[model samples]
Target: MNHNVILTCAVTGAGDTTAKSPHVPVTPKQIADDCIAAARAGASVAHIHVRDPETGTISHSVEHFREVMQRVREADVDIVMNITAGGGGDWIPDAADPTRGGPGSDIQTPRQRHEPVGELLPELCTLDCGSLNFGDMVYVNPADWLREHARLVQAAGVKPELECFDLGHVWFARQLQQEGLIDGDPLYQLCLGIPWGAEADTETLLAMRNRLPHDAHWAAFGIGRHQMPMAAQAVLLGGHARVGLEDNLYLEKGVLATNAQLVEKAASLFENLGARVMTPAETRAHLALRDPNTGHVVEKAIETTAGGAA
Candidate 1:
């Protein structure tokens, strides 16, 4: 089992979770505050995805990301901000014409999806390695587009948390490394329990982990009821942990959870498993997170200051 653990809190995902949970952050201010509260509660990193303030829908607005960054900086909390660069790729075929996209379909070019990551310049952003069947819709990420996205993220000096939903995605990620598109030790996020992807279980997570590059740093998370158990499995196998409302909505059987509560629960669980929950500073060092604009390794993990808005 890994003793030193990095706990990442994926705050609000670009999913249809807001309507199900009252605690899901919709506005930029709410998202920012949740990030701060999560950091204060022992999350090493905050995985962020902005939402449309008026409608509580997923958004790829750079300005929204900018506002969240501004608020977090103003709060003086030390959480590694890992933005989501995996949006704008939902495909629901039109009933009238199967060749065309439907009303819920929202596919974008690699450049479109990379817009927020490029502008925000977060230390880390996710790069979904390949496409998969996402519930009723197909999340499309073609090989050419993935290659382009990886190159763009590398050029920006931002570390990519390679999100692998299956074993093949991990293979393609390695191919990217072979093609010299990836920089530094590749970081992987094994996303499990999503509709038609990798199953959320011990064997599945282990199989995925065993295939990762020996030098790579990886984490894994399961959805809904499997969140905590999968986290334990990941940590026990020497990988890190990711937990939050993005993957799970409940703290227990019937209790809905806030982002902070989820982070708190994960931290507590990791500690109880004989692993120390790493601080943001420690996580940066572990991942070698860098500042894209400054061209500097961000080694400073946490700072002591009065708490800001939560």
Candidate 2:
């Protein structure tokens, strides 16, 4: 097992989980507060997604994103903010007309998907590596779309956390890295345990992990009840862990959890497994992330000196 690791809390997701759990943050302020709470609870990073406050549904509004970013920055916590560039890809075909998008379909151009990330320029952002049968609907991320998205993310100078839902997604991500679309050391988020995707099991995680680029920095997360187990699995396999309401709503069976509660639980698991949860500063250095506050890369020289002194 890796002794030192970066723990990330996916504060909220763009899924239909608002009504399932009251703890899922809907408004910009609520999401920001929970992200700050996650940071206080020992998460080095906060994976953020915005929603329509009144409707309690997924949103891709720039204003909503701006509000969340402002609040989190105002809190002045050291959490590495990771915005979602994986929006506007949900496709639920209409029963009446298959060609026409249904009520829930939220497709967008690559530029529309990258708007918030390009404007806000967080420390990190997600790029869903490929399309898959995401439950009833198809989450469409075609090759051309992914290539354009990767190029946009690179131009923004924001590190893309290549989100791989299956083994083939991992292969495609490696292809992107090979094409020089991603900058710095490529980062990957091995997303497992969703409908029709990679299973949340040791064998599946290992299979996907093995396919990653040799020098890639990666993390893994599982949904629902498998969250903690998959996190432990990831850590044992020498990768990082991700936990929050986005991936799991319950702290335990039938027990609803806040973002901080989930993060605290993940931290305890990491500690018990003999892995040290990294601080935000340390995670920034480890991931080579830019300083969100100043919009500049953290100086390697300064980080090295600080580590030596410590």
Candidate 3:
């Protein structure tokens, strides 16, 4: 295993996991606080997704994003922000009238999906590369829509993290890179253990990693029980790792975990494997990420002096 590795903490996701775990942050303030705690626990990057404060449902509101970003900035944490552009693509077909739109369908144009990213202008954003059966409903993002999103993210000067749920999605990501849609070194997030996407295991991870572009910067994450194991597997395979309550809520078999706990476990796993976890400033330098407001590459010298074992 390599000595240098980056750790990303996904603070909150768009999934409907609030009902299952009370620790999942619903409001913007709670989410921001959770992100700050994760940074303090040794997370270099934070993947954020906002939810409605009143109902705990997933939301793409720019106002929600603005509040979270403002609070995090005020806290003066060095964590890199990575917002989600993967919403507004769910479609639940009408059972009675198959051609008509269903009750739960939340389909929107590519422009709508990217509105939050345009407004927030975070350092990193996700670009789901392909569509698949996301449980019962179809999560739709056709090639044309993805192409448009790629162009938009590039124009906004935000790095796009190619989110690949399956092998085909990896191919599409490479195609987009070759077409000059994504800028700089392409970054990928290999999402495993979903219903209709790739499964979580050693063979699947190895196959997917082998298929990625040689120069690509990539991270892999697994959902539920596979989360910690996948973190160890990813580091052993010479790739980065991501973890949070969004993917798994349990610290043990019956013990619920906070977002910071998950990050701490991931950091410890890296150390157990003889790898040194990089800080946020080190991660920014490693990935060549620039500050969104300043338009300058983030220097490692500006990081806080606090240090601890990963």
Clashes of each: 1, 0, 0
lDDT of 2 at 146: 96
TM-score, per-candidate, Cα-based: 0.94, 0.95, 0.94
lDDT computed for candidate 1: 0.87
lDDT of 2: 0.88
Give the clash count for model 1: 1
| Candidate 3: stretches off by over 4 Å | 299-310
Q: Best by TM-score, which number? A: 2
Q: lDDT tens string, model 1, 1-310?
A: 7778889999989888888999999899999999999999999899999999999988889999999988986886788899999998899999999999999888889999999888878989999999999899999999999999998999888899999999899899989988999886778899999989999999999888888877788889999999999999998988889999888999999999998999889888888989888877677777778743356896644321111111
RMSD per candidate (Å) reads 5.9, 4.1, 4.7
Tens digits of per-residue lDDT for model 2, 15-61: 88998999999999999999999989999999999998999888999
List model 3 lDDT by residue over 96-190, tens digit each. 99887698788778999899998888889999999999889889999999999999998988889999999899989999999999877788889
The ten-residue window of minimal lDDT in model 1 covers 301-310
CA error at residue 25 for candidate 3, angstroms: 0.3
